[model samples]
Target: MSDYDQSPNYQRGLNLVKEMLGDRFLAGLTASAESGAFAADCASIAIESAFGAVWSRPGLARRDRSLVTLGILIASGKSAELRNHVRAGLNNGLGVEELQEVMIQAFPYCGFPCVAEAIEATIAVLRERGLIDDSTQSAKERGLL
Candidate 1:
């Protein structure tokens, strides 16, 4: 076992990440850490800080936090992270309509291109989960079609 394996903060973070993301994704991260391809310390810090410290904070609910995260990720064009958060958002009780509204709200501030890219990423996730059909309904609803 790694030295950080038994650390309270790391364990808490890991548990929180598992709750938010699921075992398979967390296992991938753990595998990366164990292989030394990705530094365990970095993973530990991210889990502890991002999940345990930040995400575990009070005031904002997990669903709301996911919304905020989605907006920022969209604006920043962080498609990969956006994909993860889109799933996280849905798991946290954000519906497809809510997520679409989030993208719509970001359109002005993030610009058409950014919002469009974000929508594409969101659609891919929704389709993967079988939550949506291949129609352009979402884009039309958002005034993008």
Candidate 2:
């Protein structure tokens, strides 16, 4: 293990991430980071800054932070991050409707195309979680059919 892997900041951030996203997701992230030194370094920075520093702060609830992160990711066209945040949002107690509303509200500011992609990413995550089905009926339920 590297210094960061043993640091209190990294450990705290990892714990926070696990609490927010669950052990399964954190395990995958750790596996990915372990593939390279640079990946490990980047992960350490993300853990310290995004999780330890920002997410661990008070004032905003995890659900609210998840929503805000979703908005930023959607507006920036960060599809991958948006997908991750979609799962995180749900984990943080945001219902599917709330996430849909976030995308709808972001449309004007982020543009239709950006919001569309974000919606697609969200749907994919929902489907993966078994919250939605891969059927025309399910698509219609979400107004996508």
Candidate 3:
């Protein structure tokens, strides 16, 4: 095992990540680590620092943090990470409407293309969780007769 695996912060992060994102993510990390891939080291640092230290902080609730993360990810065009956080956001108690509002809120700051990409990612996750149907209406389509 790596020294990181021994740290209390790493353990805390691992547990929190499991609670937030489930076992598949950790399994991917483990597989990468076992393969001795460089990305594994980066993932370890994120797990220990981002998840363990920052996410474990007391000032913001996980749901609030998820919201903040979604905004930043959308602005940065981090679609892959955005997908993961979309799932985490739902797990953290963000409702479908709240998630949609977040994407809408980002549209002005992040622009249409960025927000559109985020919306697509969010929609995919929502569909995966069966939160929305395949025929789910678009925003404009929802209100018009």
The 0-to-1 C-alpha lDDT of every candidate, in the order given, reads 0.83, 0.82, 0.85
Worst 10 residues of 1 by lDDT: 136-145
Instruction: Point out the worst 10-residue segment of candidate 2 by lDDT.
Output: 136-145
Candidate number with the higher TM-score (1 or 3): 3
Mind giving the per-residue lDDT tens digits that candidate 3 earns over 72-129?
Answer: 9999998788999999998999999999899889988999878877877787788889
True-structure lDDT of candidate 2: 0.82
Give the residue spans of candidate 2 off by over 4 A. Answer: 136-145
lDDT of 1 at 57: 82
Residues 1-145, model 1: lDDT tens digits: 5666566766777887788788998998777656766577677677767886788888899999999999999989998889999998988999999998998899889998788878888988898899988675555466774
Ranking by lDDT: 3, 1, 2
Better of 1 and 3 by lDDT: 3
Clashing pairs in 3: none
Off by over 4 Å in 1: 1-4, 137-145
Error of model 1, residue 96, in angstroms: 0.4
Model 3 collision count: 0
User: How much is 55 displaced in model 3, in angstroms?
Assistant: 0.5
Question: What TM-score does each of the candidates earn?
Answer: 0.86, 0.85, 0.90
In model 3, the Cα lDDT at residue 10 comes to 84
What is the Å distance of residue 131 in model 3 from its true position? 0.4
